[model samples]
Structures are given as C-alpha cells and as structure tokens.
Target: MYDEFTIAAYERNGFAVIPALFSAEELEEIERQLEAHLRLDLASAPKGDVVFEADSERSLRCLFRIHERSVFFDQLMRDSRLIQLVRQLFNGADVIADGTMLIDKAPLTTYEFPWHQDNAYQFWNPPDAVAVTLALDDSTAESGAIVCLAGSHRESILPHQPSGVFGASRSLVTPPNADEYPPVTLSLKPGDVSLHHVSTIHRTGPNHTSKHRRNLGFAYHTSRSVCDNAAADQYKRDLEKFLQTQ
Candidate 1:
C-alpha cells in the first residue's frame, strides 16, 4: 500500500515514520476507549499485563496484551492501514498480530530504556516482525522520544543482559557508542506512527517534560514465522530470577 520510497526508507534506516496516519477523530475515539478501559477494566487485568513505575505504584509504565483485553484494540490491530503496511513490509506475505502494548512514560517517573533490539525478547525465527508505534501524544527529545541507530537492523541480534528496569527487562550488553552509530530521534506528533524492524537497535531516555509520552505498539509477524520457544522460555526464567532479587 505504501510507495517504494517509503518502504525503501524503512529498509535503509531500519525505521520509518508515517505522519498523520490516524485522524484527530480516530485519536479522540481511541482516547475515550482507553479511558474507559483504564477506569473500568484495568482493575481486572491479568498480572504482568500491567506494569507500574519502578518507584511509584500509582504511576503506570505499560499495559500489555491490550488487543486481548480491549475490543477496541483488537479491531485496531485488524485495521487495513496497519495490516496492509505490514503485508508490504513482509513482501506481501500474510501476517499475524504478535501482540499490542501501551507504553506510558510518565514525566519524572519513568526510567530510561537501555539500548536493545526487540528480537532479543521475542526470539522470532525469521526475525522479520515489525513493531508499529502509534503516537498518542507528541514525542519530542524532552519527552524521551524513541531514538534508533540507523541501519543497525541489518546486523544480527546483539548480546543483552538484565536491565533491572521493571517494564524494560533487557538491555544491550555493551551500549552503542554514539560516535560509531549516530542516533536518530524519532520525534512525532499525535496521530503519527512509526514502524521499526524487529532487529533495530533503539532506546528511549526518561521523560523530562511535564507532559507524558504515551504510545500504542502493535507488533506483527509473517504467518510462517515461528518463535524459538526454548530461548523464549529461558529468557523468561532468567528475567524472573533477575526481578526477584531486585
């Protein structure tokens, strides 16, 4: 559905931004549904699905498996705009929704996400999944916007270790030297979306602005892709042990 230039940018830079992908009305509806979910449904959400700020239990860090919990989010994952883009990204192959999550970076409460790649946690065999992040609020440098290392997805998965952060559990074993890999801050406005490869190296700083930085992440993989169950299970066990000690 996207032009070659747009697709090419994603391939070249490991990430691409689609400006104003969602209309203001759609965003308003999204906010309304999200508010209802938080107020009425969040209390019953499964453990581990909801994560709070490390130091403040009242401050939310993320809400995972949103599509499974909210009908509005389930339908959102099936939207043609998102599905078509994912298909194009996978060379027209049919895809399946991996999961959806809402990341809320509360001002002065959220911790910085260390540099790492998504595949480190997912362990997808083909490593072709794409993460679609829909900006619910303006993301700027001061708001700890996502920053990606250009072309890093072209490399194999890097080593990762426990980060000790609540929501973000793993981090790159060796942080990327900015001189060797220049970072590109993916600043976006409300209604904008960004797509990134599973192997892309990315991280976010803690929000410094008074405003919150919130985004909805929808991940998808080709129908043929499979997860490395053994590795994934091992990672979970390791993460559990790491968290227990904290």
Candidate 2:
C-alpha cells in the first residue's frame, strides 16, 4: 500500500508517517478492546507485563506484549494492511511479529525518554526489525511527540546505560552532538501510523498538555533475522540488576 516516495523517505530518513491508516470506526473498536483489556485482563497479567507510573499508584506507564493478552490485538498483529506494509519495508521478504506494547504518558506526570536505539534493547542480529506505532490520540510537540534524528539509522548501535525511567530503562551513553543531523518531530493525529527502523536514534519529551499521550506499537522482523540470545540474556540480567536499585 506504500508508494515509492514514501518508501524512499523511510530509506533516507529512517522513518515515515502514514496518515489516516485506520478508519474512525476501527479506532473506536480498538479503544473498546483496550478498555476491556484494562478492566478484565490486567488483573491477571504476568509480572513485568504491566508497568505503572513510577510516582503514581494508579496511572499506567506501559503494557508489554498486549497482543498475547488481548484477542483483538493478537488479530491486529496479523492484519493484512500492517503485514503488507511490513513486508514491503522488508523488500518483499516474509516477516514475523516480534512484540506489541501499549505506551501511555499521563498528563503532566510522565518523564522524558532519553535518546537510544531500539536494537539496543532487542539485540536482534543484523537488526532488521521495524516498529509501527499507531497513535490513539493526537501527538504534538506539546504532547510529547516522538523526535527522531533524520538518517541516524546508518550509524552503528551506540553505548547504552540504564535511564532510571521505569518503563524505558535504557538510554544512550553519548548522544550525537553534531548539528548536521536535525531532529524531526513526528506530530500525528489519531488513526495515524508511524514506522521507524530498529537502529534509528529517537526520543520523546514529557507531556506538557492536560491530554494523555497513548500509542500502540507493533514490532516485526524479517523471517531470516534471529535474536542474539547471549547478548539478550546479558542485557536482561543487567536490566534486572539495575531495576533492583530503583
């Protein structure tokens, strides 16, 4: 469903936005399913799957692997529209859905996410994964929209350290200081979808507006790609150790 220009933009900038990919009715159903999941499924969710705001008792920060807990989300992972887009991004190669998550930023209480590459957390060999984020609410600069460094995917994975942010634990050790790579703020409306490469350098600011910033993310990798098991295990150990101090 993507045009040549859009594919070229993704290749050149390491990210691209597709406007109004989902209809309003579809979004309504998605919202209903999300609410149901929160009410009926969250209580029994696995440990570390549901994370609350660090300072607030009731505010949620993120829900990891939602596709495994919610049927609608599970089906969404295999939807033709998303599958076709991901396949095209992978140059017609088949892909496997890696994971899904719901990220929520409560109004005025959320913290900023530090700059980092997605592959640092995933540890995928060759790092060919792509993340597709669907905005449930308008994402503006005032609402802490994602900001990406254009063309930064060409760089190798940089050093990362614990960010101390509960939901997002890792951050870049030395963020790029050069001015040549400009930051592109991705301002999106509801029903909009944005895709970015695994190695793209990006971060989001804290929500300053009264409105909540919520988005659903689906990750996919080429079928030929595999996880670096040793590295992934080591990172998990390090992350667990880091979390113990918090």
Candidate 3:
C-alpha cells in the first residue's frame, strides 16, 4: 500500500519501496517465465559452462528480450498491476515501452555493483526516467541487494564510466569516505516493488546465497521524446540482440 509519506520519501530519499505489491501467483508467474527464458538461452549457449554472471558476480542468467524469450514475462510487462505502479510513479502517463530487464544474481561472494545513477547511461533526463524493481526473492544486503543514498537524485548526473547495465561501475568524484554514509539494506520478500528516480545513486552487493536472487526491473518512461538521446535508443536495441543470441 502507498501513502503520502511513502511518496514523500521517494521525493526526498530518492527511492521508496511499495510493500506487498505483487501477489504470490504473480511472483510465480514471473519466475516461471524467467526460468523458461534462461533454459532457452542455455540450450544454445556455447560449449562449457556459461556462468551467465556479468562479472565477478555470480548469475544463473541475465535476459532482456522478454517478449521474444517468454510469454509469461511479456504478460507481466503489461500486467495491470505493474502498469498501475508505473503510472503512479510517472504521473499516470501510459508507458511507451518497458525496458532495462529481468536480472538474476546467483549466490557468491566479493561481487558488488559500483555506485551509479540509472540516468547516467540514460539521457540524463532529470526526474523523467524511472526504474521499478520487482523482487522475485528475498533481498538482503549480503545477497546483492540494492542500496542508495537518500536524496542523491537531487544532484546533477555524473559522467558515466560506461559498463553493462548490470556490469558497469559509475565514476565517483571521490569514493565516499568512511565517515560519509553507510549503504541501506533493501530487504524485501518476493513481489515487493521499489520505485527509484533515475538520478538516485544506487548499487548492490554480492549474492552470497547459493539459491538465485532474481528481480525484474521495468524501466518506465513517457517516450523517446523525453529520453532525448538517440545513442541510448541504439544501445537498448543492441542489448536486446545480446539477449536473443545468449
């Protein structure tokens, strides 16, 4: 359920978790589709194990072509419940498309997503681009969970060092001193959703669990007119091809 404080928290803290958003059936549906897509990719992957993990981070799979890969995910992409949440965050504007992807982080140690803003790879559109992360598993700091600095979205977009959406690191002016701020744990059960602004500073730690920790992130935007970056559109298209071939 959402509240005034919750909305305000997103405004002030840069991220807010809307609790108990997805039903049990909904979570199962997403997982079913995700696993199916993973298997399809595995079938055609090259010889030997294709660890699917982007980097040092362990992963069972990473997929972006949901429509081409799984009907279940395509259904969730336009699910009435998901659309409503997207509408609420983007101010009731119908989404032109769904993006980012369904990411699966497998259990391991010593992997962490360096801090970065979603908009860095994006068009740097302040307050326009948003990502809704749906938890398909319990999110704990040790399990490669999302963490963010509250109110960091208010700042300007920092130039990106450029990495895969799930693999790159953000260029920090000066890594935060120990006395600065500690990362916040985004603990959530399956079906919990967190909506974050594009400029919000965020990162996740390694998934220490042997079991997979999965999440489907819907990058919602009004339209390409709002994105204002042709190169990014190209990048997104390029990413889709990577998914289909994998």
* Candidate of highest lDDT: 1
lDDT of 2: 0.87
- Compared with the true structure, model 2 gives a TM-score of 0.96
Estimate, for each residue in 113-188, the C-alpha lDDT of model 3 and write its tens digit.
7778877667744446678888988888767889887777777776655343334424454444333444566787
All candidates: TM-score = 0.95, 0.96, 0.79
Looking at candidate 3, the ten consecutive residues that score lowest on lDDT are: 162-171
- lDDT score, residue 40, model 1? 66
TM-score of 3: 0.79
All candidates in order of lDDT, best leading: 1, 2, 3
Clashing residue pairs for model 3: 144-205
Residue 142 displacement (Å), model 2: 0.7
For 4-70, candidate 1 gives per-residue lDDT tens digits of 9889999898999999999999999999999988886568887667887756457778898988888
Model 2, span 37-82: residue lDDT tens: 8897678887677888757467888899988877789888777988
- lDDT for 160 (candidate 1): 92
